[model samples]
Target: MFLQNNEIRDLLNQVADLLEIRDDNPFRVRAYREAARVIEQMTEPVASLVKANKDLSQYRGIGRDLAAKIREIVETGGLEQLRRLRQELPVSLLDLMQVPSLGPKKTAQLYKHLGVASLEDLERAARRGQIADLSGFGEKSQQHIIESLGRVKKSGEKRLLWSDAAVHARALEEYLMDIEGVRRVRVAGSFRRGEETVGDLDVLVTCGRDREKDVMEAFVSFEGVKNILSHGKTKSSVILRPGLQVDLRIVAQVSYGAALHYFTGSRAHNIAVRKLAQDKGYKINEYGVYQGEKRVAGKTEKEVYASVGLTYIPPELRENMGEIQAAADNRLPALLKRSDIRGDLHCHTRRTDGHGSLEEMAHGAIAMGYQYLAVTEHSQKVAMAGGLNEKQVLQYMKKIDAINEKFSGFRLLKGMEVDILADGRLDLADSVLAQLDLVVCSVHYQQRMDEKKQTERIIRAMDNPYCHILGHPTARLINTRDPMEIDLEKIILAAKDRGVILELNAQPDRLDLPSSYCKMAAESGVRIAVSTDAHSVENLELMENGIAAARRGWLTRNDVVNTRSLSELLRLLRRP
Candidate 1:
């Protein structure tokens, strides 16, 4: 009955979205949104805090009332205020906001003007030319919406970020393991593969064959189960409350590894492995590796791979992208591990849009066992974030200097996430940028520029000696907006030439530098900083997501710049 962190965040976000749709107090709505953000970044479960009778109000953005509401959710498994809000207004209206580039304002417009309560309704209106006539949405905007709708519809199946899906999958695995009859439970499928997004989860459980029904019953009765899709003696499927599908299978321990390998597949990888098995006069399947009906090897994934004369491939590398050949050749990379990261290069504090104070962020970094952290707040170009101007930047640097004095071992490096202006110049002047320890230049606007121009713009920014890293290189938001057409090859090469680092931003929604591109950068010998770009103390925990991405991209400890000692990293950041 424990609520996963993601569930709490989703519920809180629902409240925020409902409040926004209802046009409630802006501050109140912001509080909820901020609270959701904080909860999502938390490494520890809020439910655990609730169970311990901890003071939740101490967390940023959670006041006394929000604390009580959170407590009620943990105890009752639902929020009464959210229930009342949904009763006042149908929740479907918020789905339209999922369309790329459509904000709450536009969503409300569609709802108010065209009675568009769902994606279907909105599409019908747009195709009928009704949306074009709305006050704010003209023909051009309508065309854009229509195009975006196609993107939304084409996306199909509504996948959640791997990290988000992990929250549910891991929770369910643990919950199932607690069942008396359950001998073992492992979350398979894309979650195990470390795919950036997961559409569904396949959970394999090994329990007494005679107790299958008992396990099936418990699976369907999970607290997060929103709907039972099926119930059976050996297998059952349920859709979790957050719309993630989970399929539970009762497996025999003897075939557990084979089942895990079969279920945790990139279909092509499994097919290739099966082909290899066939060449060896054997069959590989979920049941077990068979040689003319007699089981051969399948007790472990390593056995399965070895039976085919191949070494075991890490789950992250099983994308059928030459991994089989690499495994056979014993050339697979020793992937990056979480422990290799020494510090985060991109960070923010109260000086910008971040929720944490400077000292708070530093302490959090220290708690993470980091040797250093870059306090890279936004520059003046990002006005909405309370971006710092030149004078403030000077004061901010001075503040960082003073803060650094208090810490004996850990260091707070002064820096800015300087906006890469549309024409390629940095938001901060060279003089101001020169005074900082590092600069992470990023594009906050003009994301629609043609591929060539975007590539040129980013390369030009790298030409600036102070620009040490390119933050979120593609400026992509997963499932929301497409990556800008920057030629990553060109950017990677430019970064190498300019001694600039590329960032693998660990934000769940923006795991920028997708694994494919991360591989490209690695092959080109460009170093990466797997920074979380943390905005809160909790956000620092997101570094794991970046590590996961790095592993999937075939990066090693040497491929990441942050794995170096503080002195080495400082030397690397110092561009020639």
Candidate 2:
């Protein structure tokens, strides 16, 4: 089996943990760790090289000894040394290293001194105060460890949602752009492509040399800056909020666009272009491309694209997702626009788990230039979140009516995020569903079913007339969880046939109908509803990711639900 990058990284970490316990070659351990980091940054699947019997040594940091062993494992499915290590120490011991506060050395110490093998056992020992009594485990550390363990239960997924990242990025940009001497700034990397969790935040800025120093100083002094990792005239790295690394690079005003294009990329996009340039007898580097001693493209990104014989690819389309192919064919998809969105159909208020009030949410949508807004509060099944029962739903609708009466210019549509129960039934009764202006059916539980069952369950839910849109279908949290087991092709087709809209959930963390799936849905003639699924006024802005992801799938304004005017949207909703 081809190992995923995560699997390889996990194994390397396990090796490091084993090395720490044995006090083996420190350099060997360091090599494995470095190799893991390098592999993590590699865009191409490394396991394919292993499977193909390609030289693993070709990758940087993978020296001969390690490369041979990697190939051996690929050929035999196990490393002799790793197996021996597992025999001496239970492989389950590796789980201790995954705790938030614990690293390899700490895990080794725990295994050696406290006999802790897993987070569960560690938590049990800590709660009983046994951990506090151990050598090196002080009371404060023990308390902190216990709290970290408690946090494990609350860990829904490992990564942040992509929509959330964009929201944070925009907020950061707005904050930075207004600062003195700070010129243009753009968020780069997977976050730009709308990936849920980003490893780091890459911001590119261009300013004259006179203002560069102060801009750098201001960034490092920003409120969210916890620590400055590096600071220079042109580039700086800082640990921002929640310990996320924010790397800001400054470029000359002339090269601002080129630098933004280079920095704001999925590594795959950069690599593909670099290789293309190489094949064309040009050297493409961070500064610019050169043909021998001559500078061919350096002033702007547009020139760089022009040098490569293609139109400038938008940062959003820099995923190597047919951009090169389209460039080769001299064709680029007409990306979706903000104007294509007519209204947001799923929003929440303080009546549920939302931060804003109903009136505030509606007005926020209006401020976004939306023609209509749907207040989709949680259903009664999610009682913990102040979900609405049938009576509460009716009351909320009445409140919406009163709000609509008072608020003009934008229409307020009453809706409910009806929970898709474990057995595939919507939380609300048919009567309650029928009473709503629109129903967003979503799987709120039992997301771990087998593929066949999940597909059948979702298809059954799609059959419900009140189910106008399937919310966050597959229930993926971007980089964290795998998209749930539903057969997406079947789900898309069924939704299309039933006149059900597949939601392009803009919650960044759950851009559930991904660009790839959205493209497929579009090709299948399935209508898409791009929704923010916003729980707060600020979150209403997440519709941008929805628009971007849809564009990646080649969706235009007309292909998206909200792109329609209120009358057009209502006409489509009125069908079947």
Candidate 3:
């Protein structure tokens, strides 16, 4: 198993806690804590160095004794001191430490006296009139734990984006790679697509017999592990670092493809595949697909799909989005590649409320290989948000011209996130809007308007020659707010006739226009613009989410506006 600085650090945190509770050596505890800090930031995977028998003593803050212990942890599943501490203190006592608000000291105090184990039991004891009687855990401390548990429960089901998952997955990969005889390992599912919210984590690994048990032990003992959700020979789940649940599954070399296919999913897609397998007189599971007489699909995913007379689906398109039909019919749309995007049309900067300066924003876009960037700051109506008033808008335009002047490559278009007022009028003056390179009209206020009013506002905005794109048309945040009611058909038709593009806002929280509407937008001859209504440098990465959402609508690159080059975009903008 390979251990990363973070994984080692996490393990040290647990060890440090156990030592403190056992009243063990203070310097030893400090050593573990310091070691963890050094390991957490170590760029290279630790297991590789261990396999090569490299000198770990060179690692900063790693002394002779600590390096030996790290070697012991890498080789054996457990350390002698850590095992002794565990024997002295119940493993269940770690549950108290798992609560968000409880620190190691508070956890030790609770365990030393009250004999609390799990959070549920602690809550019961606290509420049943026993906590106040304890020495350090007065009403305030008790209340804090209860509140923390409640908050944890409420926020539990939320998913993490792929970007966040990579951090955790890389840590686990490093820890597991250190184990002997383990081969390739990779992360699959929504994390691969870079989706913002991840439901469960799936890691695929290949290993030999001796390594499996050792790997499982090390995996279960991972510093981030809060609870052993479940463990088995082929698979195991552990709640690591808060409510984030990670599930790891191991496979023999042959079954790797089958296992990955089974895990990477939209449940609907899997079910469809299973039905196909049934028709072909075979059974498919995480292990391998079997015919009544023999095993067929265990070695590779392509083989698994080929058994069903279909092409293997790409991970991004494994959402049952007519993939099965396309596979059977051999008509799957070639999904858009990252390189298809020519420019980023809707972005924010410090000239408005964005975190980075205009130059920084453009440089970031350029760094992402964008040929052009539309610097669309907020219009004057949103005054509270440092919106660009008339003078500020002109001054910013001049600044943008200066920026374009200094920069040799890539065009920066002057634009604004103009508001669609309650009266179905754009907030910016027509003459003022005409002076800009592009305009994106969106709804900021009046989200509560009736469907007729909202539809009319959107339609009226689309009719304007200056309005290049209708940003996040319905103003809905997935799983949070209901899409504002609108006559989408009528509005889409208007946009089509007016040659206006409807934006699929790439912000994770607001993948607006919904996938269904985007399909309709595409059919209406109204091009769709997948733009990251980015407020910061980091926000530009939200384009993946936009692409994912667009995929759900069966969008092709040609149907998207931003896929057009600057000349093409200008040509479309010049349409009557």
Candidate 4:
């Protein structure tokens, strides 16, 4: 039984969430949560280490107690303590956390004070006027809860981040390839199309006909499968531990390409392609493309495209969004690739809320082959991050300059994620801003400003000569909060007019500058800075997510600023 790191991490997080719900020791809960984060970030499999008898305690956050808990989970697929805690706390209480703005602390208060055990219970309490009377949750809080319940129900079928799904998909790929007769395995569907959130994973496989039953059996036994939905000789499906449902289909190698094309679809894209095939006197399906009762093209995806007289479309562009026409016109974009990114422009250091020191982040950038790294710490407007004042910013700039002298072929660009004050003025003065390599201004607070005010506020910041880019432009958190009401199109126009770049934040929850808006920016001739907004060394790896998001937006090398060499990038940031 092999468990992926994310699988282990998710189970650990469950324990943490449970502990916090019951008002357990804060340090104890943090330990489990930290251990989970360490495991999730690990490239190596925790299950493999346990099998090898390696001491998991060697990992930074995993202590003796945490290591023992991990061992129990690895050996038995669950932590005994988590099961026991669920019994005492009414596991359904955890479900209450799904409501927007309703956190564990609030949930605990609700449960303790009102016997609220589920979403239904909470709704009843709020509707009965009991919640508004409670401490902390006044009329507005009760109203917000009432408003958010519908969203919770509508979004009940939880989705996994594409990155998380990829981890499981890769594990499944290795597992299937190890089978005696498996020929090829590829996870299709939105995963291939690189949607930010995936409803489920669809894996297509090709294998020896004689081994079809064996493949199906092995798939069901996949280590992370939480429940087996079905089992058959040629097809099977299972729900993984983290609530991601995966389906497996064994096909002959002859139809692999056709099956893959059909599976890796936006539905609308597939429909568009079928229309093309029909017009070409061909019928395309999962089996093969038929030419009036004769098989014509099916061996490869490129062949599938050629049969219809079109170039092969990359999966990221298969959104039925002018891609087919673009392919016919030979206008498909040369989309951005991971290798195109040369530096991370929006990194934070220990000077603020980040866990990494200047030297540590510089080394991490070096490890990732980055030519430069912009240490963009928050300004004083964000008091929670211990945002830096002018004095602190000046001190950090000197540190960056000193640090740069020590490393050849690497530079630490002094930058700040300055706040765009509610009235549209920058938080920092030009005296300090002029001393930095770049300035990334963002709206960290007052996110709920009316659309007109929000739009004007960001546009006003773009007018600042020192502002090089806008960070997480829309301020939306995936599955948690909706995007700010700022007119992204207006912002894009302003960025183009003022030479400000827009950021594609790579954080899993905040893949802001959603691909659609990114497309808007690119088409307007505004460059994007695909920064990880990394707080720690490990967070820099999130550039992969940003690159994926960038490609989805039809961005290319020339469309991104950081893709340039250090000299070229510095030249670009030079303001008029």
Q: lDDT of candidate 4?
A: 0.89
> For residues 456-489, could you state the per-residue lDDT of candidate 4 as single tens digits?
9999988889999999998988765667778888
Worst 10 residues of 4 by lDDT: 94-103
Residue pairs whose backbone atoms clash in candidate 2: 161-508, 161-509, 162-196, 162-508, 163-508, 340-563, 342-562
TM-score of each: 0.93, 0.68, 0.70, 0.92
Model 1 misplaced regions, further than 4 Å: 51-53, 84-90, 129-141, 181-183, 208-214
Task: Rank all candidate structures by their TM-score, best first, as comma-separated numbers.
Answer: 1, 4, 3, 2
User: TM-score of model 4 relative to the true fold?
Assistant: 0.92
- Model 2: number of backbone collisions: 7
lDDT of 1: 0.88
Q: By TM-score, how accurate is candidate 2? A: 0.68
Point out the worst 10-residue segment of candidate 2 by lDDT: 156-165
lDDT comparing candidate 3 with the true structure: 0.77
Per residue, candidate 1 scores C-alpha lDDT tens digits across 1-576 of 678888888899888888887788999998888888878878788999999999999987789988998899899888999999889877887778777767676787788778898999988999999998999778877887888888778878679988999888878888899888788899988899888899999999999877788889889999889899999888899999878999999888899889989999989999999999888899999989999989988888898999998898999988899899999998888899988888998988877888889999999999999999999999999998899999999998888899899999999988889999998999988989989988999998878777899899889889999999999998888877778877788788888888888999999888888889899998998888899999999889988889988989999999999999989988888897
Candidate lDDT values, in order: 0.88, 0.77, 0.77, 0.89
Top TM-score hit: 1
Per-residue lDDT of model 3, residues 1-576, tens digit only: 444344555566779888877667888887787676556435465666777898988864679888888778777645787788778888766656545546566667777677776677778877876777777667765765676567656755655544345668777888788778889787777765444467767888899876787777888999768789888876888997535688887888888888888878767888999999999899998778899857787788898899888987777677776779988998877766677988888998766666568887888898888888999998878886678777788888898999898776689988989988888788878888989999999998867567888888788777777888888888876433457778888888888888888898877667776777887888677789899987666567768778877876778998887889888888877758
